[model samples]
Target: MTWETVPLRSVARVDAVHVAPEAISTSDVYVGLEHIGRNGAIDETYYPAAREIKSSKNRFDGRHILYGKLRPNLAKVARPRERGVCSTDIYPILPGSSVDRAYLAHFLLSPEAVGFAAARTAGVNLPRVSWSALGELPIPLPPLAEQRRIAAILDEADALRLTAICRLRLFQKLEESAFELVLSVSR
Candidate 1:
């Protein structure tokens, strides 16, 4: 399939929100850089209640894709399920025009996109891709239906990978237990 391409800004709004402390309710959810996972995963448990944070943060709804801007190589980006606040290091991007949010999230996690961010990253120790640089990155634009289809396929692949990793860990634990039992018998 011939996938048309566009600048990242053409299909999405990056760093489009900033919320004052008082404006956000204590009950609101807060997503930090740690909450985002590699390859578009999100660890919801890592988030804190909005009241726990004192400084200003970016506001985002479920529609936005939360991305970790601090280290682009980590590929920390995800689509949240509810409205919330996130760290300044995490950009909440909202898809525009014919763009699919899920597709956009997957795209951000792609090697090419991650490389683009990594290349544009600034700073010595804490390298980061400024919002302006992120917006200028190139992105593929497929039809909305196709985008959803591609996203679904990618999601299934991700699920399979997670399952495989889980099984590997379980097997390792079983092996460790068996080894311990053998040592006890030898003693």
Candidate 2:
């Protein structure tokens, strides 16, 4: 399908939620930028009780896309299913009518979008892309129907890739254990 390229701002609201730390309850769900995995996996282990957070954070709901604006090369993006507060470094983007949330998240994680964000980042050690720059990113927008189709296809691929990575890690661990056993037996 033919897609029309448009600036990200045209189809999404970047960092739409900005609230003070005190504004949120300590018991609320918290998502740090580090909690966002490179493979669109939200690190469930990183959720600290809202009271544990000392600084301000962005609030997002199920409808928004959580994007790691800091160190964009990591390509961290996810659509959280719950309402909660997230690290200020992450932008809680809301997609417009023409764009689907899943589609936007996948696009943000794509190599083209990631590279575009990386090129616009500022700072040498801990670079971050500003909301303005992120909003200006060029996105190839397809029809809503086509976008859903693309997103579904990408999601399936991502799930398979994650499964393979997990299996590989498990195998490596088993190999290490076997090698250790062999060395102990020889000793």
Candidate 3:
């Protein structure tokens, strides 16, 4: 299949719905850059209630793909599982009808995209990728079905990698325990 390359703005838009602190509900979940893990994962435990937030925040639903504009090299991205408010530092991207949220999220996490954002970041301290710059990023577009298939494959690979890392950590812990046991017995 021939994939067409287009600017990210052509396939998605940044939903800049900033809700004032007073308008935000206490029960609303709030995600900050720290709440997002590198490469499209969310640190579910870190989200705070909106009541604790003092500034205006962007509102997003599960359909939006959250991209951390600050420190884009970290590739902090995620598909929110529920409606929530996020730091203005994050761009809540809403994929166009032709685009798939998962596919778009994976693409944004790609090395090319991360490099693009990193290179374009502005500011001496706390550098950030502006919405205009992010919107200009080139994206490879495939057929909807192909995009879904590709996303599924990538998801499976990511899952396998995580499992392997978990297993490796468990083995390391076991080794440490065995070494301590041997030392204690010798003593």
Candidate 4:
């Protein structure tokens, strides 16, 4: 039997959410809306740490896909590194190693999943994506090798984009410095 497509709940366990503290600390690693990128990469540095995070918040550390369960937040899914420690509002998805996390991440971050999550969101304030709805999400699966290959391509593209951004910023800084020096001398 080919399980080309499977419900997320089958390959994973969706935890009952534990609410985190109102604030974060350096000791506590927080996973908030900003940590995850649209491309499914987790920029850990972006997620600030607080001194303390509440225990009730979902603990997604190591090898799990981190998902922002709050409405527009669902669009920011990523696979966290250093496993364990995240904001109370962030939902952690631990994908079975058997399933390539990169592949699963792509699926979760897909437009389809975002729409699904949005439809089920409960709160009027933030349009929270319900865990049950998230769990029931159907994901497209591919073999491990294929998943890795896809991930690698995505990673390469990201690196190139970042490189270009740095170059652009550096040039801008140079221009500003030169202008400042010339203008200062003219004055």
By how many angstroms RMSD does model 3 differ from the true structure? 1.3
- Residue pairs in collision within model 3: none
| Candidate 4 segments exceeding 4 Å error | 1-3, 15-28, 37-51
**On residues 1-187, what C-alpha lDDT tens digit does candidate 4 reach at each position?**
3647788888776553454555334555566676767766666665444434445556666677777877644487877667456655676777776577777777777788888888778888877776778888887676778778887787687789889989999999999999999999999
Q: Candidate 3 regions off by >4 Å?
A: none
**Top lDDT: which candidate number?**
3
Residues 6-59, candidate 3: write the lDDT tens digits.
999999999889899988886777889888877577777765665678899999
Using TM-score as the measure, what is the rank order of every candidate, best first? 3, 1, 2, 4
When summed lDDT is taken over every stretch of 10 residues in candidate 2, the lowest stretch is 44-53
Q: Point out the worst 10-residue segment of candidate 4 by lDDT.
A: 16-25
Clashing residue pairs, backbone N/CA/C < 3 A, model 2: 26-51
Using alpha carbons, what is the TM-score of model 4?
A: 0.76
Output the better candidate (1/3) by TM-score: 3
Query: Which digits, one per residue and each the tens of the lDDT, describe model 1 over residues 1-187?
Result: 7888899988888755788877878677888888776756667675565566788899988888998899899999999888889888988888996898888998899899999999999999999999889999888898999999999999899999999999999999999999999999999
Q: How well does each candidate superpose onto the true structure, as a TM-score?
A: 0.91, 0.89, 0.94, 0.76
Overall local distance difference test of candidate 4: 0.71
Question: Candidate 2 on 113-182: residue-level lDDT in tens?
Answer: 9999999999999999998998898999888999999999999998899899999999999999999999
